[model samples]
Target: MAEVAAITEREIELISRFVVLLKDEQDALKRADPSVLQEIGAEKIGLAEQLNTLEADRRLALGITDDQNTREAMAGWLAQHPEESTAAVNWEKLLELSREAKQLHELNAGLVAMHLQLASDALTILTRQSEQHHALYGSDGQAAPVSGSRIVDSA
Candidate 1:
């Protein structure tokens, strides 16, 4: 029998959302306040579990779940019916699937790098603006009366 090949739109969307949410979680973990780290950590873990469950469901729906169990069951069936015996499943298909999966992961990693770059650039711009404002303001834009010294902290 020919193999079934199908993936649902909902599954694809779920996977995409999971990737984006995971990226956000990682970014937030790095930048969140110390007091809120626990909340961020718990939320990330829960989102990860949801992603795993969705992926498992997708794999099962694709009829490609439980490779070891399938192999064992097939072996038993073949042994029980010698006349219907067929050669072992072609593993090349599995390899192809693995390669596709790796490609998707690479794509995801690239997206994460892009997000980081954009965030870094924004922070750089904001820092420069703040520095400019502070410099021109002369400490709240207050001019020193007559003669006075302004102290700047190196720290």
Candidate 2:
């Protein structure tokens, strides 16, 4: 039962913000087309790698490197053995993906807003129909033969 050390105040705050952003992204993602989520998720993995780099540096600086965490140590080794490495970090690619991710996020928000509006309109219509049914059918479930265009909000 090894307990993880408490995060620093700054880390805690950053994590809180990250969690909020992720949740917002998820909510926005719900109303988005599958392609939107797919593109964003793909870009997010790259951003995640960038984040991992920072985390690795922080871990080493704190002398918390564990031998079992081989991959975590690989980044450090890569720095020392540049000639031996074949992979490279493309800042431009990262930047492009980040831009695409941001765009997808914006699109997701707009879609969610549209969906919410549609849901609200649908609910209002249902409510009105139910009220009309109550008036015509006298309580129990039944439809009323009435039709009209109703606006939920005046704006």
Candidate 3:
């Protein structure tokens, strides 16, 4: 049916958009831009919701009320409509892009974790050094020791 074809096109578009978003997110992570990353996260959330709705519509268009029937319906429809067989190709492309997006996300997460660990290590070193040193040198060029408090503050 025309509705099924339209839904398939919409799905391909959405998957393409998802792949683009994933690439943008990966770039944001690479640049270490928290604000940009947050913006990208919001965008990804919106896209995810859109994709979920589109998926439901697709299932409905294919007469697939349950997920178990999806493959069977899709195969039958493709067999009946040889002209629209390209939908299966598009579906394959979507799957490939989805897999790529997942891998990129995983890599981004690992990069973020590495950065966090580096920051934590640096903070630890700074805090340890600050704890060992009581105070800085006074105007007299002599080391000024504090009574009982560690001077240099860390968050």
TM per model? Answer: 0.34, 0.35, 0.70
Candidate rank order under lDDT: 3, 2, 1
Itemize residue pairs with steric clashes in candidate 3.
Answer: none
Better of 1 and 3 by lDDT: 3
| Candidate 3 runs further than 4 Å off | 66-83, 130-155
lDDT digits (tens) for residues 88-128 of candidate 2: 23322333444655675676667767778988999999898
Please list the C-alpha lDDT of all candidates, in the order they appear: 0.48, 0.49, 0.75
Q: Where is model 2 more than 4 Å wrong at Cα?
A: 1-89, 133-155
Model 2 whole-model lDDT (C-alpha atoms): 0.49
lDDT per residue as tens, model 1, 1-155: 11211222333444455455455555554554346546645764675576467546545543455664644544454455455322223222333444554565566567657767988999999898656544433455663232223444221
Tell me the tens digit of each residue's lDDT in model 3 across 91-139.
6666677788789788888988988998999999989877666556666
RMSD of each: 11.7, 13.3, 7.6
